[model samples]
Target: MLEGHPWFQLEVLAASGKSAGNKYRDAANWILEEEMPEEVGNKQVEQIDSKIFENAGIKLIFSALPADVARSVEPELASSGLFVFSNASAFRMAEDVPLLIADINGDHLALVEQQQKSRPGYIVTNPNCSVIGLASGLKPLADNFGLKSVFVTTYQALSGAGYPGVPSMDIMGNIVPYIHDEEEKVEEECDKILGKFTGEAIEPLQLNVIASCARVGVRNGHLESVLVELETDATIDDIKNAFTEYKGNKDEALPTAPEQLIIVTEDESRPQPVFDSYNGSPERARGMAVTVGRLKLRGSKLRFFLLVHNTIRGASGCSIMNAELAKIRGYI
Candidate 1:
């Protein structure tokens, strides 16, 4: 979608290994072949020859490969001097590497200068799906009001499990209690995305994160119930002001960016997957903004419910926005 921005026109030079197919490749092909034309018939999107990006100038590469597969391809792309923004889990925890949520920590890009030691590639990884929603919602609080810890229960979407995802028979009318390594990823990634960068390395926030993950029947969006422990004193009104009055790069009116990063709702039974999943502006709330509702204050802790588009903002949309931010900062 960043490539579709008013100022940016992208000619995708893409290829994939001979196999069933990858989730990213499948989705990109859908955008390139079906969705783009229906959305904007005048705009032209073409697929270039494989070697064109190698010989011709190329700005950046977004890797959606599985973690291990990304490890090998990333070096080659970087060796070619292409900036990489990866959604894969590989290198996410690297000391010198950056785990970015453009809204949360674009400063982490400063560490890109250190990529010279590794294949001339600078990689930035987006956090786990569950973490993306939690991190973005907490970022504003962490910046203005201090966040000390968070406990979340994620009702994740099936797509996060990947293509041929879960068996229908198992999930048709059921909810699975556990997802392998998912809780760990959510626990670790939230801190990383909300962490502090020391110029050369990132020190994840001291916020203690505990998570419980479940697989739900929803086709899109991950909904989380969060309990945040705050250090400084704050009231329900203060938290509401922080979220409702929020504006971001999307708000400042970046073409592909969402207008708000967080949306706080007063409706007690709000942020339901089927109901609010598609709310908000064209690109802003299409699962991009972290929808927070059911705010309640108990002592120093603030509790709320959140919903985020898993495949878009949490996954592909977040990656696209990061690339756009990098372009804005000239990192691409």
Candidate 2:
């Protein structure tokens, strides 16, 4: 998306030691040769090393490295005066780091100034892939009716496991009921993302959040079943309208901003990953929208299911949107 954007330019492509193999290198070469033939022009993946920070012209770094690797280098990259928008779990919950969801809480970017006081550059992160969808779905409800507690059970995609992912034999016809620290990340990150940014500090929401995560057989899109208790009574129509009416910085004209952040579906069979996985509007925003279905309201409680493209709105596209938000907010 950044490559296609008018304001942004594609810079260097760096790879970790594990991803510097012939296969990965060849793939990067192929993409440059085929898709970005004119612009990239014979570029090859450079090994990410100490000298990687030598590029003074590079102002931003987008990273999807493993947590430990990211933690090891992010500070150095930031200290080198390069803003980092990362997808790794490292530094996500740091009080000085902003866990950003562009439309939902762009105000969180305010924390960047505080971070810059300590380092020349700063880091911003998107939530866990699964958490992005759940948080996006919850934001509207929390804004309209206020949330008391949230319970989510996620059916995450295989690709979320990264390259090589889950062994086909283990996941071909099975559902693994555990996914590392996914549940805990979701539970904690949601509160911070949905919380208030009081200029000086982030006050996490006091709502209760419980999560159960599993790896499913699907190739893309994380699907979740959520049950939420509201702080106040509201009608079913009111709940539906909150979703339909919700728009997160859509009018800002950000390159990757989805026309509708949340798409509330009325069909009982809708929001399936196969069809709704790419949900969004205005072409550029495809795969950036969260689709919600099977909404059920009982008194002040609500039940629903949502889908988010695990790698797009949940991962890389999420980081791209954060960069755009930062640029618009003058942090980049």
Best by TM-score: 2
Tens-digit lDDT track for model 1 on 1-332? 54445654554535454322333333343422225443333333333232456665665777788887788877677777777888998888887777887777878877777886765657878888888888878877787788878899999888788877899998999999899888888888877777778878778787778999999998878999999888899888888888866565442344545666687777889988877665556654366777889988999999889998787787877777777777777676
Model 1, position 143: C-alpha lDDT score = 72
Which residue pairs in model 2 clash with each other? Answer: none
Q: What is the lDDT of residue 87 in candidate 1?
A: 91
lDDT score at residue 100, model 1, on the 0-100 scale: 80
CA lDDT of 82 in candidate 2?
Answer: 85
For model 2, residues 98-175, the per-residue Cα lDDT tens digits are 999998988898998998898888999999999999999999999999998999999999989986889999999899
| Residue 109, model 2, lDDT | 88
lDDT of 1 at 153: 94
* Residues forming the 10-long window of minimal summed lDDT in candidate 2: 25-34
Which pairs of residues collide in model 1? 312-317
Off by over 4 Å in 1: 19-52, 117-119, 248-253, 282-285
TM-score per candidate: 0.87, 0.94
